[model samples]
Every structure is written in structure tokens, then in C-alpha cells.
Target: MTEDLTFNSKMAAVYEKNTRISIPTYNSLFAMIQSYYRVQLGEKAASLLLIGAGGGNELSAWGPSNPGWTFTGVDPSEEMLKIAKHKVVELGLESRVSLIQGTTDDLPKTHLKFDAASCILVLHFIDDVQEKLKLLGSIKDKLKSGAPFILVSAYGNHDESELQARLNVWKSFWIDAGRESSEVDEMVRSAITRLSLLPEKQIEELLAESGFMKITRFYSTGLFAGWICHTE
Candidate 1:
């Protein structure tokens, strides 16, 4: 069986295009998020923090639309950041966008408090529940009080029937996107066993414990869920 794609240069080369095809409601989900940020923070001089800011897709979406919003995008993957940097340069957003090749904890300590933050399609990669909480906590620490946070992730407890059902649908989504049967099976297997996804309840608990409030989900596609929250 083929291994799951890692965030290396090879995957980074085709990441943008492949993700657009593989993930359901790919465009609209991010559109909603950017629109929400625009309406919610409108004209306010704010710095938006992006965790797992791979390829600067968020920057590309939000930068052109909201000129007042500056972005600090952090990701552990250097290859991914290289692609994102290129995008930033291409967009002529170098003046407004900052890319960091590290996790949130690696973000430089400063008096700068982010007014908004996002962690789209991330967090689920962490296998340990405590580590997930720590990641969220680290994000919370960087933001100002009452700042909005958008989090999107794939989730479902492995032991539950609901997770199994969602996994079936999720794999079908890939297959429908034109992936071969064997590839889909291997991808599905990796997602189920290799990825560390949590149940909704535990995720909520982790968010709450990490100082996020008003945790409400605004979108869901198969096993993936998008949440709008606040750091308070």
C-alpha cells in the first residue's frame, strides 16, 4: 500500500491543487472564514495569526480582500513555508504577511497580541490529547482577550460508530474526487489509524480548557468540522 503523503517538497508541489480536489466544500469553507473575519473585524487594524499556515492559502484569501489585516503565518514545515512565501511574494503581500517556519510555541515572544487566529485543517495531527490542549493554549496565549479564533479539523473517535460512518463517507469523498481504489483505501487507513482525531465532546472540552469561549461550529463536511471561537 502507498503511504500517506507527508508535507515534503513533493507533496508541497501539488498541495494546493490536490487539496482543492480532495476536500469537499474546499473553497466555500475558507470563503466563509475570510468573510467572517472581514465582517467581524472590519477596518480594524489587526494581526491575524495562522497556525499551520501551509502555502499561505489563508493569506492569499484574506490579504487581497482585507487590506487592513496583517498576517503572521506559522508552520513547522519548511517546504510548505517555501511555497507560501512564493505565494506571498507573488501577491505582493510581503509588506503585510510574515511567515514563520515553526509551530506556535516557536513564535517569537513580543508585545504583539494577535487580534484573530486560525488553525484550519490542523490540530488533528496531534496524537496526544494533552498535546492538542497545549497547542490550543499556546494559540490562546498569543491572542488578546475576546479575540476570534477559527479552527477547522478532521475529527471522530475511533471506537465510535459515528466515526466509522464518517470515515466511510470521507473516503468516498476522495474516491469521488477521482482517486484510485487502492490509493483511497490506503489514505483511509492512514486517516483512521495514523491520524489522531478526537470526538466532538473531548475537542470542546480541550478548547474550553484552553481558554476559548463561544465555541460554535459553523461548518462540517463529512468528518471535518469548522468552529468559530474566542480567546477570553
Candidate 2:
């Protein structure tokens, strides 16, 4: 989690592979999100903020289908954004997609309100409760009221028994999914010790305090969940 928001060359190269091995239903979850946005936005020419848009996955998934929609993909990792940029170019979406190498706070304050936003698998890296709220608040500030925001991250009850049970199952899933034992052990250790996973209820409370409402969980597997929230 120390480098979850930013990635080195080696980590970036293996991210797609390792993520598939570790996170169950990784591609399917993205597909569901794409469907949700497309159905919700219709033919409207909307702008989207892809907070922590690493590897350009969101742009690649959402752009070609919604040709009218534009995206501002922000991330702290230059290496990750490099791939996203190349993907945008390859998809010939350079005209509609803007890539920025910075955190959400570094985004230019614009009168242009986003029609929707997504912060996926990003915020848990910031363990500080206040910082997490601040980050969500920043994203909320950019969105128009009633705009849907998709947020997905690892979260769980912190009880020792619950965490241990889930951790063991998660570790086995990774190992069974072809990850080597050493790598699985290391990842499980990091998840247990380094990652800050607040309970689901606490996460929802923070979101509500950050000005999101009608939070709906659409996907969940292992301790990870995805939600569609509205700024109200």
C-alpha cells in the first residue's frame, strides 16, 4: 500500500498480471462499471474524472463506447500515466481524453463540473481517516450534484478473527490462482499489516460525511467492494 498510488517501473509492469491473480473478478468488475456509466449517462456529452486512473483501464474501457464523453485521468505515477497516454493515443481518443500527472488535489479548479467521477482501488492506500475524507471531499467538490461517482477499494472489519479468516481465504485464492507461495505470503502480509481497511460501515459514514449519498454496493469479493455514490 505504500506505493499503491504510485508505481515503479517493475511494479507497473507486473500490476496487470498480479492484480488478476490477486483480485477476483478484476476485469468483470470494470465491465460492470462501464455498463453502469453508459446506461446512466445515455447519449449525453458528459465529462468524467478518473481519479487514480492507472494503466488507462477506465479510459480504454469507457472511451470507445461513449465517443461523446470526455475524460480527465489523473494519477501520481508518471509511469502509469505513460501507459494510459499511450492507450489513449492508440484508441485515437487523444482529442477527448486528457491525461494529468498529479493527485486529485493537484487538479486545476475549473468551472467545468464533472458529470461523473470514479476513484477505484485508490483511497485505501491513504490510511489516515482525515486524509481519506479530504480526498473524497476534493472529488465531491468537482462533481455536479446528482452526478454518480464510482468508488472501489479494499475494506473490511478490523476484528482479529474476521480479518484472519478473510485473510486466509484471500491468500489461498491467490495461491490457487497460480501466484507463488512466497509472493502470496508477501501480499497477504502487506494486506494485513500495511493496508488500512476500515470497516464497511465506517467507510460508508466517511462517504456520507464527504457529501455522497445513496451509496449502493454493486460488486464485492474478498474484502473489496465497489460502490456507486451520488453527490447530493
Candidate 3:
């Protein structure tokens, strides 16, 4: 699992390029998140905490638009943090954004609480489902009552047989780009796999058990995108 973290750090470096190929889907999902935040938090100044904040892309997109907001991005990878720090500087958002290097299991509890938090494409990497729920529970504790926690994860609604077929297509695409078989295997394994997909019901139940109220699924796309939000 530690090696998985290293692989994820490498993956983050290539994320921008990968997302470009899937721009429409990514845009729609981000739009949903933004709209949800605006409606839930209203027009007031707010603070946001981003868990697994690889590359700091989300903050870059959302921060300037909401000038009064402050963002704290936390991730476990030093490589990813380096990229995020550089991005913050490049965007001239140093005053609005802060980067912290740590995992959910080791987050600093002393930091000021946030108005909202997001965990995008992060929970699946945690091998234990219970631990993942516990992480969400901890994040909820770091928020004031009525604060929102938005999450996105792989959905389990896709046909497993078909997804495997499409993954074979992706595998071929990687091979055509000159990656070796072992390299492709490692990448595919570390990327979201079928096994990582969780059902929508399970997600809502976990969030509820973690003390989140008013949990709702907002957007989903063939097991690729699943967005949910709840309040503390």
C-alpha cells in the first residue's frame, strides 16, 4: 500500500493530461460540485478543506471565483504536494491557499475547522471500507454543524463485463503509446478498478453512520462519477 502511494503520486503528475481526454465528464462533475457549494453555503465567505488534494487543480479553479474563501489542501505524497505548492505560487494564490503533507489518518486536529470539505476520487484507494468511513467521520468532526462535506467516488452501477472490455481498450491505448506490459499493469491496478467501485446505498449509509445528515447523491455517470453531499 505504501508503494501504491508512490504510484498515485506519479499518477497525479499525469492527471492533467488524462483529464484533458475526458474533459466533458470532468467538467460536468466539477460544475456540480461548484453549484452545490454555492447553494449550500450561500453568499457568505467560507473556508474549504480538500482531502487528497492532488495537483491543487480544484482549488485553482474554485478559489479565485470566490475571493473571500480560503483553501487548505491536504495530501499524503510529497511529490504531489510539490506540484500543488508550485501551482499555488503559479496562480498567485499563495495568500488564499495552503498545502499540507499528510494522510487522513494523520491529519492535524488543531487546525481551525472549515465550512466545507471535499474528498474527490480519494476514498477508493483506502483498502478498508470501514477505515474510509472513519476518515470521513473524522473530517466531519473538523467542521461546524451544518457544514457540508462533498464527496465523489467510483460508482458500482456499470456492467462489470462491459467495463472490463472498455478497460481492455484503455490497456491497448496505453500499449500503443509504448508502455510495457508490466508498466501498464501497475498503472491499471493503481487507477480506479472495478473492485473499487462502491454502491450508492453503501456510500449514503456510511456517511450517515459517520454523523452526516441530509446525504444525497447529486451526479453519476456510468460508474465513472458519483457525487454526494451531507451536512455535519
Candidate 4:
């Protein structure tokens, strides 16, 4: 299996524990985005594209109240897909959801179009800012005019000191577990690198360059939480 799959498999096994903290934060973020879209679009049901959907926790957050919406979730990890599929079946959301194993690059070929799309907490994991921009551009291509695109990523200059402090603790633990120094270094490098954490002005500039209009920061929390939306 690919290293990405290996890492995601390990993550899937432990993601529930991680979500104890992440879910609440992301849930609130998505909720605010949804409210904004509801008011702006005036639609109860939306066709949503979720890039790097992971275990489908975002769908669960939307809940049964918004039965009009349908989600097409895409991720690159088979292991993560397994977890998400299981949750979809268990929650009886199979009818409202479709899970695919791929990245944002594959969306256009999937022949799917969406009224709205979100890439939350997924951009930083991508190592290339240009590639991430290409993916966002592809989403814009698939959306109809006036459709909304929501993006959330770690914000640059928000509070790197805190993240760096946390990474130090994580690095020590990984080393104590007998991981090679090189492996630990790679982990630390990934954590500290902020591929999408450009300044707020820069983010808006990039969004405009990608053919999106009316870009705005919708929410933020420390350096970790950020939300921006634009229309096609």
C-alpha cells in the first residue's frame, strides 16, 4: 500500500480519540458555514462536495434535520473510506451519501457537480500549495455560477508558538517509542509546515486568482481554525 494509505490506516484506528477535541471545533465551524450558505442561497437542500472527507463526521454533524442535502465525500485512503462507509451504513445515510476513494484532482472526471464544496482541515496535510490551489480551482470549475466554496486551514501567524510547543512534545514521544530520528523529523516537518496558512490577505488574493469572487474569512480560532467562502 502507499505510504499515504498506511498513515491513514493508522489514523483511522485512532481518529475517534482525536475527534474528541476536533469534532466540537469543526462542527461549530461547519455549522456557521452552513448557516451562511442557507441565508445566501435560500435553499434547504444542497448538493455538497466534501474533499478529504475522512470518516464522514461532517455528515453526521449536519444531522437528520437537513434531509434535503446530499453529500459526495471523497478521500484518498481506503482505510478511512471503510470507516466512513461503516458510519454511513450504521446511520442509515447511505441514501443521502456517496463515498469515493480519490483526491480533489479526480473530482472533475467523476462527472459530479456540486452547489457547495468544503475542504476543511485537509489543506495543510497537502505539501504543495500550488497543487492545493489547482484542486480548489477544479472545484470552482465544477460548481455552477453563484455556488459557494468553503475552505478551512491552519492560519499563518495565528499562533505558531503554541503549535511548535505541542509538536515538541509529540516529537519526544515518537522518539521514545523507538522511531528513527529521520522518521520523527519527517513528522515534525509536516506538522510545522503550513502549506495553506498564508496570511488572510494572501488567501483572499489566491481565491480571487482562482476565479472565486466575494471571498471572505468566515471564522477563525487561534492559528488552527480558519474558514473562507467564495462564490463561483
Candidate 5:
């Protein structure tokens, strides 16, 4: 499977719409994450390190609501980061949001540590298990102790009947959202070629190994699942 999941200019332009269509609960998931963070940090000022922050959806969803929060968003795709930068400017969040066109590994070494972090819809793109762990570990290294972290990813044992059922439901969602059957089929086929799925049990294990604790799954929609945890 190819691990290069970065979007081209054409794909980046329609990312938001396509994401909303493919994941029916996209807004709900963002809302829940924002709510969780608000409840945890309260009125205190906080910094968030957003992994795969390319599309700017997280900033669009969380920035206005949490005036005390600042963001350092990193993504590997230049095209996607362009969209994020555009959103930051359009939302008047330029002062609070920094968009970086690279991975966490590219972030400069510093004493700065974030209050919390999130990796949304990004992990499954990495086909190598160790690379996934490394990314998680890098996020952990940038966070303060006990910092809350959210991980959302597409995961399942493809051989399992339950996963197959969820996949069918997911495909139906795309169809219902106005994607042509052939387009949906092609999308699914493309996703399968790039997606790296793990069972929930394995994901939890990865969290543990990455120095995160108190792992709790907070949301599930179709084939996508989200977990909220804290740094050790």
C-alpha cells in the first residue's frame, strides 16, 4: 500500500466537501472534540499541536469558540496547507494559528510544549506500523504531561464480517451524499490501497506504547473511530 496520502491541488480543493460527504458525522466529531477540550481546559489559555492540520477544519471548528486557544498546525501537504492558511486568514485567526507545511518531525526543536494535541483523519495513511508509532511518539514528546490527545482514524480488520458491514454502510453514506456509485466504488478502492487499518485492540496498544494513558474511545461513525486520551 502506498503511504503517500497527500492530496494534489485538485483533491485539496474539494477536500472539505468530500470529507463531509464521506463521513456523515464529520461535524459531530469535531464538535465533540471541541467540547471535550473546552471542558478539560476551561477558560485557561492553551496551545494545540494539530497533526495533519492541512484542511483547516479543526481551526474553523475550534478557533472561534475557544478564544483562549492558539494553534500550531502541521501537515505534509503543501496544497492542503494552502487551504488552511486561507481559512486562517479568512477567519481572522492569523494571529492565533500557525500553519506549517511539513510533518511533526520537521518542527524545530524547542522548549515549547503544547497543552493538547490532535491527529485527525491522518494515521491510517501511514502503512508502516512503526511510522505510525513514531508519529504518535513525536506528538507525545511535544505535549506537556497529562495533556489530552485525540486520535481519529479509519480502523478495522478487513477480514472481519463486522468491518465489512461497516464498510457497506460507509459506501451507502457516500452514495446517499450524492456521490455516483462508480465514483464511490473508485473512492473506496483508492482508500483501500492507501489505508492502513488496525483493530481497536491494536490501536489501544499503540496509544499505550506512545506514552499515553486513560485511553477512552469518545466517538464512532461508520468506519471512523475517535479516542481521547492523556499523556503519561
Candidate 6:
């Protein structure tokens, strides 16, 4: 197996391209996330904490239109962070974006709380449920009361036939996008091996346990799901 999930330099170089290929509605997902924030926060100056900011997609998509928004992004992958930094520079958002090369735990102890946060295309990478809770708890701890938060993740029980059927459709999406069948097969295998897919109900449980409320499933495509909620 190639272990393509690892965000090394090689993978980082092609991350955005591959991601778009894998998720047909990739761009729209970010747009929806921003839309949720816009509806909640309005045109006021607000700070955002982006978990898994290595891809820079959130920074690039949300920065220009919301000039009043400032972002602090944290990711554990150095190579991926390099790509995100380049994107921030390219977008000329140096003043509004801060990229940190570490996890939320590495963030300095501070009393500052953000107005919003996003965890897009993340979470599934952790196979452990406890770790997932920890990440969600950390994000909750960083937000002000009733702050909006968005989470997009791969979900569904891998052992079930319904999810397998969805996986088949997901594979065809890649193949239709021009990826070689064998390559797509391996990618799917890698995903099944590495991703920690849970049933939708379990994901909601995690959100509620982490002090989030009004959890609503706002988006779904193939194996991926998105939810919007507010910190409690």
C-alpha cells in the first residue's frame, strides 16, 4: 500500500488536485461552510480557528470575501503546512492568516476564543474514538459560547452493505474523473484501511458529548458527511 494518507511533501504537492478529484463537490463544500459562518456571524470582524489547515483550502476560500475575518490555522503536517503557507502568501492574506505547524494541543495557552472553527475533510484519519473526542473537545474549548462550528468527515459503518455500495459509487466517481481503475482501487483500499469510519449516529454522539448543540446534517455526498452546529 502507498499509505497515501500521510501528508508528506510528495502528497502535499498534489493534495488539492487529488482532493478535488476525489470529492466532486470539493469547492462547494467550502463555500457552504463559509455560507454558514456568514449567516451566523454577519459582516463583523471575527476570528476563526481552522483545524487541519494544511491544505489551505479554507484560508483561500474564506479569506477574500470576508475581509473582516482573521484566521489561525493549525496542522500537524509540516510539509502540508508549507503548501498552506504558500497559498496564504499567494492570496496576499499575510495580515489575516496565521499558519501553525502543530496540533491544537501545541497552541499556546490563552484566554482568546474564536468566533468560528472548521474541521473539513479531517477526523476520519483518527481510528481511535477517544482521540476524535479529544479533538472535538479541544475545538469546543477554543470557541465562544454559541459559536458556529462546521465538521465534514467520512462516516458510515464499513461493515455494512449500504456503505459498501456507497463506496462503489465513490470509486466510480474517481474512475469517471479519469483515474486509472487500478489506481482508484488502491486508493479505495487505502481509505478503507486508514479511515476511521463510524455510523452517522455515532458522529452526532461525539458532537453532543463535546458540548455542541443544534447538530444538523447539512451536506452529504457518497461516503462524506457535513454537519453544522454551535458550541454550547
Q: Let me know the TM-score candidate 6 reaches against the reference structure.
A: 0.93
Give per-residue CA lDDT, model 3, range 1-232, as digits (tens): 4565556556655876665343336766777788888888889888888998867778767876888788888899887676676667657889988778886556566777789899887777776788888888888887877887888776553455766665565566556667787887887676645345566777888888888987777765433455465664
**10 residues in a row with least lDDT, candidate 3:** 16-25
| Candidate 3 C-alpha error for residue 32, in Å | 1.9
- Name the candidate, 2 or 5, with the larger TM-score value: 5
Displacement of residue 110 (Cα, Å) in model 2 is 2.5
- Give the alpha carbon lDDT tens digit for every residue of 1-232 in model 6: 2343333435555887778877889889988888889989998899999999997888889998899999999999887787787777768999999888888898778739999999987899887999999999999999999999999999999789989898888888889988899998898787565799889999999999999999999999888999999997
TM-score, predicted candidate 2 vs. hidden true structure: 0.89
Tens-digit lDDT string for candidate 2 (1-232):
2254344434545777767766778889989988888888888799999999878878877889888899998999887787687677668999998888888877887648899999988978887999999999999999988999999988886665876777777788887877788987887676656887888888888899999999988888776888889999
- Candidate 1 Cα misplacement greater than 4 A, ranges: 1-13
**What is candidate 5's lDDT per residue for 81-173, written digit by digit as tens?**
877876787689989998888999888787399999999999999999999999999999999998999999999998899888888899898
lDDT of each: 0.83, 0.83, 0.73, 0.70, 0.88, 0.88
RMSD to true structure for each model, in Å = 4.6, 4.5, 5.6, 6.0, 5.0, 4.4
- The candidates, ranked best first by lDDT, are 5, 6, 1, 2, 3, 4
Residue 41, candidate 5: alpha-carbon lDDT: 79
Better of 1 and 5 by lDDT: 5
- Output candidate 3 Cα RMSD: 5.6
Residue-wise lDDT of candidate 1 within 201-229, one digit each (tens)? 77888899999999998988887888899
lDDT tens digits, residue span 46-148, model 4: 7888887877667776645578888888899887787777667657888999888998665557565688888877776766769767877877887777888
Off by over 4 Å in 5: 1-13
In model 6, where is the ten-residue run with the lowest total lDDT?
1-10
Question: Candidate 1 vs. truth: CA RMSD?
Answer: 4.6
The collision pairs in model 5 are none
**Clash counts for all predictions:** 0, 0, 0, 0, 0, 0
lDDT of 1: 0.83
lDDT of 6: 0.88
